[model samples]
Target: MKEKWRLLITEKNSAYRNMAMDRAELVSISKGNTPPTVRFFTWKPRAISIGYFQSLEDEVNLDACKNLGVDYVRRITGGGAVFHDKELTYSIVIPESHSQVSKNIMESYGRICGAIIKGLKQLEIDSSYIPINDIIADGKKISGNAQTRKAKTVLQHGTILMDVDVEEMFSLLLVPNEKIRDKMISDVKQRVTSIKHILGKDISFNQIADAMRIGFEEEFNIELNKGILTDEEIELTNKFEKEFFSTKEWNHRR
Candidate 1:
C-alpha cells in the first residue's frame, strides 16, 4: 500500500519554531492524521542546536553564544551537536508501516538520500549517497541526516550546507584544543564540501527548496500535496517551545 505524502514549507527560522514542528510531526504522524511530511526550515540569527541526548555544555561555548546572540535548542532526534547557520534544514515524518521499504536504519537513510543525490545531480555535482545518513561528492560530504522513531511514526532531519563557516563552526564547538583535533579537523575538511563551494556562486534558498521538493516526488513517484500544520499541533508546539526548547535547562543539560 502506497501512502500519500505532504510537502510543507515552514514560515520562519527560530529554533523554537523548528522544535515545535518536531513535536507536531510526532503527534500528526502517530495519529495517522497527516500524511508523511517533508518540511523545509531555517534558523534565525545563526543558532547552534544539539541533539536530545547531547549537552550543549559539553559542546558549545555558552559565553560566545550569549555574546554573539546565537540561540540554542535540543532536537528530539539523536546525533552530535550542529551549528545551524542559516542553512537549509529538512525534516520528514512518516508512519512506520510503509511497505516494500525499510525497517533497517541504513536502508531508510539510503531512501532519503536518494532524493538528495538526485537534487545534487541537477547541479552537475555527481554526488554519491553514503550509508548511515550522508551524501558525499568527491569523497566529501554535503549533507547529513538523523532519524528517530515514535510508536508508529518516524521523524528524520538533516542539514544541507549552503556556505558553512568551518572555522567559526569548529571554534564554537568544544573540540579538543590539541594537535589530534587539528588533524581531525583537516580530515573533516577533506570529506566535506558545500553547495556554495561546489558551484562557486550563491544559490537562492528558494531554488534549493524547490529542487528538494521536485527530487522527492521524482524519487517516490508519488503526488505530494502542499500542507499546513493543524491547530492542535500549534498548541502543543507553543507549549513545548515555552517549556523545553527555549529553556536553559534543556540547552545545557547533559
Candidate 2:
C-alpha cells in the first residue's frame, strides 16, 4: 500500500499570508494535528522574502519595495533573500520521525530536493541538485530552496523560477558594497536562469504544479490526496499573519 500525503495548491496570495500559512502547516503537522503536506502557492503583487537570519536594512531596499508596491516578509527558514515573482513556490512539511527524512541537514536537503530534480526532468529542463540546497540547469540556478526544523517537523520550501528579471530584483535588494553591485548583478545573471529561458517558451503554473506533483509521488512512492486546510490551520494562519508576519517586529526582527 502506498503512503498518503496531503497536497495543497493555493491561489496567489499576499506574502504575509503565504508565510503564515506555511508556518501554520508546519506547526500542525509537527504537533500531530494534521497530516504531512505538500503545498504549492504563488505571490500576488510580487514579493521579497528574506531568510530568518537576514537583516532587512543590509539585504533589502525597503524604499524600493514600498515604492514598487511589492510585499516583503521574513521566512522561518534560512537562506538568502529571494525575489518571489513569476515562479512556482512549493513547501513540504514532514515529521522528523518519518522514515524518509534524514536527521542530517545536508542529507535531508538532498532527499527533499530529489522531487524538484525529478520535476525539472519531467519538464525537460535537465536540472541537477547542487549540494546543500539549490537546483541548477545548464550550469545556472533555476531553483532556490530553504529549510527549517522545528517542533519535531521539517519545513522545506523553495522557488522554481518561471522567469527572471535580474535588474528588477537587484533594484529591490542591496549589496554590501554599492561599488560591487553591478559586478554582483553580472555574476548572478551568469549563474542564475529560469524555466522560460531554458525552454524558450512560457509554461503555465498548473503544468509546473502537475509535474512537481508527479515528481513527489514517484520519489516517495506515495499518493497525494488534494486537501483543503483544516479549520485549525486557517485560524492559526490568520493569527500569525496579523500578529507576526504583518508586523515589523517579526519581519524586521533580524
Most accurate candidate by TM-score:
2
Q: List clashing residue pairs in candidate 1.
A: 140-191
Question: C-alpha displacement of 126 in model 1, angstroms?
Answer: 1.8
- lDDT string for model 2 (1-254, tens) is 99999999986999999999999998899889987899999999799999999998889999999999999999889899999999999999999999988889898898888998888888997988897689999999999999999988999999999999999999999988899989999999999999999999999999999999988888888998999999999999999999999999998898
Model 1 per-residue lDDT tens digits across residues 70-157: 8877888888788888468888888778762488877888888887777777666778777767788777889988888887787888
For each candidate, what is the lDDT? 0.79, 0.93
Which parts of model 2 have CA positions greater than 4 angstroms off? none
lDDT of 1: 0.79
**TM-score for each prediction?**
0.92, 0.98
lDDT over C-alpha atoms for residue 76 of model 2: 89
What's the residue-level lDDT of 112 in candidate 2? 82
Worst 10 residues of 1 by lDDT: 175-184
